[model samples]
Target: MNHDNLLAPYAARSAASRGRKHEEPYKDSRPVFERDRDRIIHCAAFRRLEYKTQVFVNHEGDYYRTRLTHSLEVAQIGRGIARRLHLNEDLVEALALAHDLGHTPFGHTGEVVLNRLMADHGGFEHNRQSLRIVELLEERYPGFDGLNLAWETREGIIKHSSQYDHPGHPEDDDFEPHQRPTLEAQIIDLADEIAYNNHDIDDGLKAGYITLDELAALEIWQDMSALVSRKYPHLRGERQAYQTISHLIGHLIDDLVQTTTENLKAYHIDNLEAVRSHPDYLVRLSGETARKNKQLKAFLYRQLYRHYKVERMRIKAERFVTLLFTSYKENPTLLPRKLQQRFDEHGKERVICDYIAGMTDRSALDEYKRLYEPYERV
Candidate 1:
């Protein structure tokens, strides 16, 4: 697995990879991170992402961004950023692809209900569940219970700082919370933000939940609008909207690259050691872009995320997850035979939680109907 790489001095080199939790023979063609990426892609949990929620549920629409597409978008942006900065593209790609593997079917709504249900066991967070997935849930290889991913990949999953994920929580206790993750891992967070924000804009527009005229009120929207107009004067309607999003993504990446490069210089961080030991995170957007991005986020929160339609989905998601948990808790026999066998080892509630968390949105709904309708297919 020792492949020659032209990584930045501060980049995470594959040769220096902290070995997996379980030892295994290495492959010759693909490097460690590449294998990690392939392993994630082949896992059952990763495939379930197609039906997992991002903003809209699976049955909501065909075109809306699902968890699968969102993960792909994050990887696309992360790889572009990684390449530009001479960072580890393979690790960045792996982190981006694997980051959302632990997300529940109904998105944050599912996570909230699981947290409430498992309050006495251990609170549920997608990030921790993600690590749990790669560490012990995915029973792929004969010798290992989980993927036994490289330690750096696992650390990135644990500490993937995002708008939804804040650091210093008890969950981060497993690692050195004081030190920063690799430069590549650090990029995943910002890349996630960049992907979700812009894609949300697109999905909201396509769904008619948000209008172009409404977006005019936001400064970032106006900035992009002007650029799109000038760059392609004849472009109109949906095409204009699409191009504006493309332009915005480009601009954000430009800002992030520029800002991260400047931070590297400002901190005099010459190597991976310096990046880890730095007191604060050094990869970031410039001040101006940060403010603009925040404004856009606020607009999405108020206008799109908190809008009546999205809230309605969130409410139903809560109920579905809650009822499912309750039913399983009352009658453990209701769970599939395989999961029932896990109860003795992991506890009934934890086993049930894992079973439910692993379900796709469509399958969860199907399970509900099968359980409640009586006449529905078993």
Candidate 2:
């Protein structure tokens, strides 16, 4: 079936996509956004997300969410919202999956170290790095360096923002940075928060970073826990925690859908033009949900993220990234031959940052050992 036939006027229909940077023939059956989604899923950078950390380090545990799983969860949530609103699910899914393509291994700590290291050389930001990946990094097509994604998907990735992410892609002048992105792109921002917050709660509890008694004090957790207990009276322990988290995700999705619908009506957004011209995001939480979410984030910051154990891992990750960047900067020959050639075009600091940003957690660690350890195999 032709998917483009179903998009609403306000939706980003594939037939009308801004198209790729380098023009290519379209596969007749698949919509452009669907092709974009397929291309992203098949890219090498997408696969490396598995070894990249979300909260805990890659070596911390098998159960903690990796960037890959987090991306999938964001896509699932984004699609749910898109379907509910008759928006473009394919575009939402593509944005969701591709948003984290440029994330460094070992989570935000790695980003911090790399940013400081590159301060003299244009600086580093994951959102910009993500755009760089799609526009320049991934070498899939012989004709193009990056994935050559549609302009909309690239904009969505650049606009990916949340409590932690401060989105900006100054180099992406093709898309209007001053205005809001499509509502489908906006959904990924909320989906990222909903996915990470609830999943982190599970991981935190399992890691014994936070306790049930302590969680009981939080408003959102308590509200969901009561619902889980009422619905599954016999469920307890890990099963209960799972059920509660499941309900909480549903709760957040419900709030986002309802509130976003209200905002759409309030703003008089009729088509894609209105969404772009709007000054602020049209998709967001209700006042009540936003207030409660603030409490939830504040609690996580003081209780889980700032916990001494998590800080220890952060320190280690920062050290790994700093040392690795410094070594490569001192001697550019250490990079792979192909990357060494790019140093003339991309420059030493940027080429090194690209190489480091592209590495998976274990790959970064292994590289560290190879360079610093006398006995480690190169």
Candidate 3:
């Protein structure tokens, strides 16, 4: 079914997409953005997300959210917001799923080390790496290097920003860096935040890094917990925490949708052009919600992210990433023959960066053992 009739005037319709970098004849009934979402889901990089870090390392536990689960949650939340706003759900889902395609192992720690190592080699950022993965890395298409996704989808992947992601790259000039992306793209940014913020609380609780008593100090958590308690007085322990988080997510999503809708009308944004020409982002949470969200993030930064145990893991990951990059740079032959062959085309540092960036946490650890541990098998 054509989704055009259901979309708002400002929503990005697949028909009006800037189209793919390498055009191919339409071979299916799926919409352009739907096809982009499918291609992203099936790609090798998407599969690797299962082993990539989110807040916790992949092997830490079976319950914590990995990059793959985070991406899925982001997509689910994005689609919900898109549906409520009459935006293109397919495009939003595509953007949400593809947003983290470039993240390295060990969460941001791996990325930090790689950027420091490649300080003179254009540096490494997950957002830019995400764009690179879709535009150049994946080799499934016989006709193109990357997935050959829609221009809007590509723009969303590169422009995706959150507390963790800062998307500014010299190579993204072609995506109209000055203009705002579609509302669908913008939704993924906040959806990502909403997913991670709430889910991180869950993971942190599960990991014993945080406690309900500690979380109750935050106004957002206090309010949500009170509401959940009133609704389910007998609820306690993990179930109570889960209910509180569920209520918190719903509150956030409602506030975001209401605030963004008001912003659209206040700014006289009735069409895609107005969305693009608008000086500031149209998608946002209300002032109060934004402040509460900030408080929660600050709490997490201090309590969970900067916890002693997490810091220990970060330090070890930094050493692993740094040593891997240094060893590979010092010995070009250490890279697989296929990766080494690309060195002449993409430069030694960048090829090594790509190889390291594509690694899963488990793989990186295994590779470290192989390289550094004498008894470990090659």
Candidate 3 — which residues are off by over 4 angstroms? Answer: none
Clashing pairs in 2: none
After the best TM-score superposition of candidate 2, give how far the Cα of residue 213 lies from its true spot, in angstroms: 0.9
Q: Order the numbered candidates by lDDT, best leading.
A: 3, 1, 2
Please give the distance, in angstroms, between residue 151's alpha carbon in candidate 1 and its true position after superposition. 0.7
The C-alpha RMSD in Å for every predicted model, in order, reads 1.5, 1.3, 0.9
Q: Give the Å shift of residue 113 in candidate 3.
A: 0.7
lDDT of 1 by residue, 24-69 (tens): 7765657778889999999999999999999999998999999999
TM-score of each: 0.97, 0.97, 0.99
lDDT of 3 by residue, 83-143 (tens): 9999999999999999999999999999888999989999999999998999899999787
Global lDDT scores for all candidate models:
0.90, 0.88, 0.93
**Could you tell me which residue pairs clash in candidate 1?**
none
Q: Model 1 reaches what TM-score against the true structure?
A: 0.97
Candidate 2 residue lDDT tens string, 1-378 = 767567666778887888888977654768778888998999988999999998888788899999999999999999999999889999999999998888998888888888888888888889899888888888878777888888888888888887767665457576787878888899999999999898999999999999889989988889999999898899889999989889989999999999988888898888999988988898888898888888988888899999999999888888899888888888878889998988889898999998999999999999999999999989
Between candidates 2 and 3, name the one with more favorable TM-score: 3
In model 3, what is the error at residue 348, expressed in angstroms?
0.1
Clashes of 3: 0
